[model samples]
Target: MAAANSVWISLLVSIIIVILFIQAVPTAHSQNDEDQLIWAKRVVSGNQVITNLQFYFHDVVGGRNPSAIRIAEAPQTKNSTTFFGSLMMIDDALTVGPDPASKPVGRARGMYGSAGQTDFGLIMALSYVFSDGIYDGSSFSMLSINPATETVREMAVVGGTGLFRMARGYAIARTYWLNAATGDAIVGYNVTILTYV
Candidate 1:
């Protein structure tokens, strides 16, 4: 009886350990997802629309190369537009700079462009090449638009030629979020364009 009781206690302890491990694994994964969502929400709320975006370099090993780029955009209610208005502009250069005078230039149009077309022209121009978990190339400047005035404003630069150029393809992953109040029609259409230069 004593031996049998000891064996049962050991089995119960093992089962408890397994249960704890299973629970901990998911909590760790959830933490990462939570961080991503928080960052996405912050990008959606900040002013200077398209306020802050960043890129990081991953050390390469052997013959393998690694890098990443993170692109974020924040469109405030003030910049929100009607279903028929323009949302952003993409130029041929890294336009957004520390100085307000150094912003890039691009034609302004609606999110879907004229006639309700999917204008991935900006993403195409920036993403010159796409490969397995890697995007090799460079892109120009990106500009944001003011829905009210329809004027182009310097929002942020994805990949510039100078110091900013090093940030190309630094973000290996991306996440996008839209305000809950903004109906799915308009929310799903808004995008932040980044170059994998």
Candidate 2:
């Protein structure tokens, strides 16, 4: 009886050891892990829109690459009209002229002729190529601005070339100043984006 009892005790101890071992070993489905196995977000997964990006646009003849010799040179259509192509410089404040007195950070070059049949002459779609700061090689289009809603304008990010190839996004712009005399404007923008390279 003593031997039998000892044998039984040994078996019980062995079973307890097995149970403890199983619990101690890490299991894929265990809920006791300090950290779970998961994939992390990639670095290029997100980018922020640089806010308060300022620019000054001077509506002058030959201002754009296509060259709007004059405002009348703009296309006049029943459903749309074209405005002069404009060149602007990105600055830090509400600038008015092409020659920025101060706070010039980058330069913008591209076509900005307006089109579409919108009674608001100021209301039209514009495309401009950005050549400074993080906007290098990327061009964004102010698809259209409703004078009624000119307080906030959305610029469509068309595809880019080179470093900015396959760019997709939009820019939020607020007009800081508008000169009725020359059709010049000071605009501010905020952009958020992501790129592969």
Cα RMSDs, all models: 19.2, 20.5
Candidate 2: residue pairs that collide: 49-191, 49-192, 79-116, 79-117, 80-116, 80-117, 83-114
Most accurate candidate by lDDT: 2
- TM-score for each predicted model, relative to the true structure: 0.18, 0.45
Give the TM-score (vs. native) of candidate 2. Answer: 0.45
Instruction: Using TM-score, give the best candidate's number.
Output: 2
Clash count for candidate 1 is 13
Q: Tens digit of lDDT per residue, candidate 1, span 7-55?
A: 7887686556545533333211232243232111111111111212222
Q: Against the unseen true structure, what C-alpha lDDT does each candidate score?
A: 0.26, 0.41
Expressed as tens digits, the lDDT of each residue in 31-143 for candidate 2 is 23323311011123123222122344433332343223333333333234333232222222222222435333334443333332443424334545555546455554444
